[model samples]
Target: MANFEEYKNIWVYTEQRGGRLMPVALELLGEGYRLSRERGEGAKVCAVLVGSEIGYLAEELYAYGADMVYQMDHPLLKNYTTDGYTKVMTDAIKAYKPEIVLFGATHIGRDLAPRIAARLDTGLTADCTRLDINTGNYMKYLTDYTTASSSGLEANDGNKGLKQTRPAFGGNLMATIVTPNTRPQMATVRPGVMEKRERETGASGQLVKVKVELCQSDIQVEVLDVVKEAKELVSLTDADIICSGGRGLGNAEGFELIRRFADKVGGVVGASRAAVDSGWIDQSHQVGQTGTTVKPKIYFACGISGAIQHLAGMQTSDIIVAINKDPEAPMMQLADYAICGDLKKVIPELIQQWDEEEQQ
Candidate 1:
């Protein structure tokens, strides 16, 4: 068994793009800080940044509660390559031996995390929506015998293990997976699921520079150029207010009204999976389990039945407004405000009233 006592601190993979840090990375640092406080008094929160000329970004990590920042900077590490990044990350993990590692479940993280887990021969929990230090009866299920022989958590208490929870069974159920025997319990959390802590007034952390042995031969693929996609579609994840349509809109034409409502509120348009599948809207506007998870400030659900899959995505929104003729619909019951009327009629009236108030 690996030595559990040797592992220390919670590490967050601080991902960056075009020299700027991704919001999800900072969000993970916030969560790591919270997890450190919850786990005990002495455990530190660390940020592992891998890129070219990103030494200056370490300050942002410290401000977001990172007690330490691990810098793996090199020209070869500028852009993300599965093989090159995986090699350096694996080497770092072997050397530092962190107790927990958090990655944002972005395209990069999803690809890199599994590779690291495979190299270390450890378990990885993906798309985690919740993370906490395990406690109570849940700890009973986590016994030394349940852990793999290669796991480093054999001598540790179950309470100290990271609890990684995600929606499973097609979003019908929630499951919490743990790596009790593993030295570094790894998880990839969805963006916006965790809140970023307030920046510290003048906090800073220790910066550790890691030099990895890498060469051109190690990279199997070559990048010719990076093409950026046009921003024609609405970004529901970053939208403060969202006006989403469902099957209730009846057809693709129904979205015309949803668009108007969204425009009136200065919000973006979202759609239920049913709407996207029905060809009423594009899949980019889909909001639910199979689509993007959003935590907007205000979410307006018009004509949606509020399936469990859909609710799993937007339930975290600060405020939910359900507009459905069916008073007993799940969204209606769960919404902060429910309007038991046809959205076709109600939406126009709402817009008209807002316009009138604005004119006055």
Candidate 2:
């Protein structure tokens, strides 16, 4: 019953809003490039842009490594509501079949990827941190009859596994999965996790524009008015510097000190999970397995206990500075520079020094 006769290439769901491409689109393009190369075969990394007059953005995808661009320019697709996007994308997938599909783990992606996979009856590995090809499993998906047998993606070749890796077990471990039996092995990768390819001017790829079927009844939500978030979007991902404090601060008032230090340094204030879970700070300020992953130019850990969950999020920061009274603390050991002094004293002095330098 599956249309095994159709489809080729890898697909990254190009989510466009306000005429700008999100960073996750670029990240997937980077990974797709490497995965295509590993196969030692030419596989088009396609960008599926579904919306109104979004064809102009298709060429930009090619600069980021897309070999082909599929555009579904429709009037009903002007704005994104779950129902509308899923409809158009599903239609496109049924038209031009792809091997692997990637989506950003942001709000829209988290909402869309699973639904699309369910409708197509395909296996999807969500929130992947890494991706690679495995030839050993290519034949396995074909012979291995399971949930993956439903999607019409089969090559009469040997096994080539697509490995997707992500952090698991509360960030205590990492897990790698292979889609040995599914067509368009889908995944939702975290934002800011992968590097974006360099965009080039005048780079072009093949374009296929398709008209999709749509009805007003298909749209579930009606647009009232659009609202924008506050001017400062709290870009923890792009933060140049961060100041984090944890349970060592011990109480709510302690964060005032941390906030002051952060304010002086023109940095965002971050907190360990313990501090956040204990209700000392806001959820957005928490850093760790359940928090935002950051790679700031400088990250300061103050009065914090370094649990692996907390470290998992900020470990990848460019430079880590820590101040813990207990010199033997795990965070202190991992810090690029560790201070074994009381934060109550250290913080004030540092602020004073920065002030003096500013005045001079």
Alpha-carbon RMSD to native, per candidate = 5.4, 6.5
Q: Assess every candidate by TM-score.
A: 0.88, 0.83
Model 1 agreement with the true structure over 1-360: per-residue lDDT tens digits: 678899888999999987899999999999999888877749999999998899999998999999999999989988889999999999999999999989999989999999999989888999998886846423443442124232344334556777787887656477889897777889999987788999886788799999878998999989777777775677888999999999999999999999999999899999999999999898889998878899899999999999989998898789999999999999998899999998999999988897999999
Across 40-95, the per-residue lDDT of candidate 2 in tens digits comes to: 55777888888887888987899998888888888888887788888888887877
Clashing pairs in 2: 99-184, 134-160, 134-161, 135-159, 135-160, 138-159, 138-160, 139-159, 141-180, 141-181
Candidate 2 stretches with Cα past 4 Å from truth are: 1-7, 134-159, 251-253, 263-266, 277-282, 327-329, 353-360
- Model 2 lDDT on a 0 to 1 scale: 0.81
Error of 1 at 198 (Å): 1.5
In terms of lDDT, which candidate is strongest? 1
Worst 10 residues of 1 by lDDT: 144-153
